[model samples]
Target: MGLALQGEKIARNRFTGEKIENGSFMLCDFSGADLTGTEFIGCQFYDRDSRQGGNFSRAILKDASFKSCDLSMADFRHANALGIEIRECRAQGADFRGTSFMNMITSRTWFCSAYITKSNLSYANFAKVVLEKCELWENRWHGAQVLGASFSGSDLSGGEFSGFDWRAADVTQCDLSNAELGELDLRTTDLQGVKMDSHQAAQLLERLGIAIIG
Candidate 1:
């Protein structure tokens, strides 16, 4: 189940339930393709391919830019996505476990109910993204921009967020234990019903018009 296309366009093709594995598609365009329930394992989608609104499962998209594509509900378990720009996609319910998102621009993406455990999201821009109820355990978000993102009811335990911005982000009712939130602006962010330690609570209160006396 492999297709090799060199400098071709694959637009508006309904590939539902198609299994494409171990194929190389260089400079192929997949815009407006209904790839629902499609499985792409060990496939390489090079530049000039806009796969907007496509489904993938256990896809090995290494060095791929499935960028500006609506990949909502795309399952990418154990995929190696190093240096990929999956930005501005409808990626709700996407599974990105053991994936590397280093220097990726995932801005304005929707990852609601997505499982992203042990992923490297360092230096990624997740601005204005919706990640409600997502599982992000042990993920590295160091030096990432998460401004105006919604993480309500999400599990963020053991997540590394050092030097990440949480300004205007809704993190209400989420777990933040052992999570590094250094230099994050939580002033306009909602923290109601969220679980935090005493030191974390004191730090948050200090930002909310509370003075701690020594």
Candidate 2:
């Protein structure tokens, strides 16, 4: 159905196995809805109808946990994502570009070929997440937890992963220039083919127990 329910109340509805196509729900409320295995096409989830964002800010999506759902090309720009669990889902090409997320939790999620660049991702939890071929540049990820996650072939330049367990993940062939990697364990991470910021070189060198000579 080509539903254009912008800024409507879609809360507490069971959208189990529903197929949304070209649906624009910008500034709408999808809180407390059962979105198990729901697919989307050209669907807008964030508040994009105006300058502000977040359509499902107060929505509850804690229903049946199923896998194999496609959310490609869906727009979530500047959306409110408080208390949302994006567990075990495939977000291929889901447009999260320029979105600032607050208190986000994504476990066992596959962000393949997605664009989340310049997003504020502070105070989030990403366990068992796979961010393959994603654009995550210039994002703030301080006070976040990344466990058993892998970021391969992704552009993570200028991202802040500080003040957290920045290890316990495989981040290969990705850019890291101008990024905050303080208190991170490099014993398990590689610096080859990775761009580094000149200001952050001393911290990286100090972590390797190497003193710089003037």
Candidate 3:
């Protein structure tokens, strides 16, 4: 159950059921590795330069748990991350473009300035996550739980958030133009300085009992 690294280039490496507790992997290259069901408990990863990014591209990371990891500037593009649980992870500036996160649970994770475009995030839980200045356009968030999460200054114009519960979330200064806002709960959410479409603004005003004068 200990941490193990094999292969010269670390490509096509498999590590199932391995326990990597409290490990600090700085500037490690994990590109194209099959790390299915790996338990990364309390791991810290810091990529100072963009060139020293941790790559998890095309990796099968199903059911993998990353608890309390500092994964700043890590690249997880095109990774199969089904049912992945990433709790309390500091994932600032991480690239999750085209990553499949079906039924994933990501609670209390800080995704500041992260780019999550074209990702499949169906049935994902994002409770209490801070996504400040993040680019999450064209992402599918069907049936996702976003309770108490804040997305300040994020660009989510092309994201699908039709039935997502955004209560108590601070979405101030975020661009949500053309996003599906049908049945979205904005009761406890802050919509101050948020950019909305003309139709969307009318609908939101109607919901708030405000009469619009043409």
Which candidate model has the greater TM-score, 1 or 3?
Answer: 1
Across residues 60-148, which tens digit of lDDT does each residue of candidate 3 receive?
77777777676656677777776565655655456666666543247644234344555556545455655667666766666665666
Worst 10 residues of 1 by lDDT: 51-60
The all-Cα superposition gives candidate 2 an RMSD in Å to the true structure of 10.6
Per-residue lDDT of candidate 2, residues 62-132 (tens digit): 22221222232334444333222332333433433333333334764423534455545554445555565
Q: Give the C-alpha miss distance for residue 71 in model 3, angstroms.
A: 18
Best TM-score among the predictions, by candidate number: 1
Off by over 4 Å in 2: 1-111, 188-193
lDDT of each: 0.55, 0.53, 0.66
By lDDT rank, best first, the candidates go: 3, 1, 2
Q: Judged by lDDT relative to the true structure, which candidate is superior, 2 or 3?
A: 3
- Relative to the true structure, candidate 1 reaches a TM of 0.52
Clashing pairs in 1: 53-70
Model 3, stretches more than 4 Å misplaced? 1-111, 185-187, 209-213
TM-score of each: 0.52, 0.50, 0.48
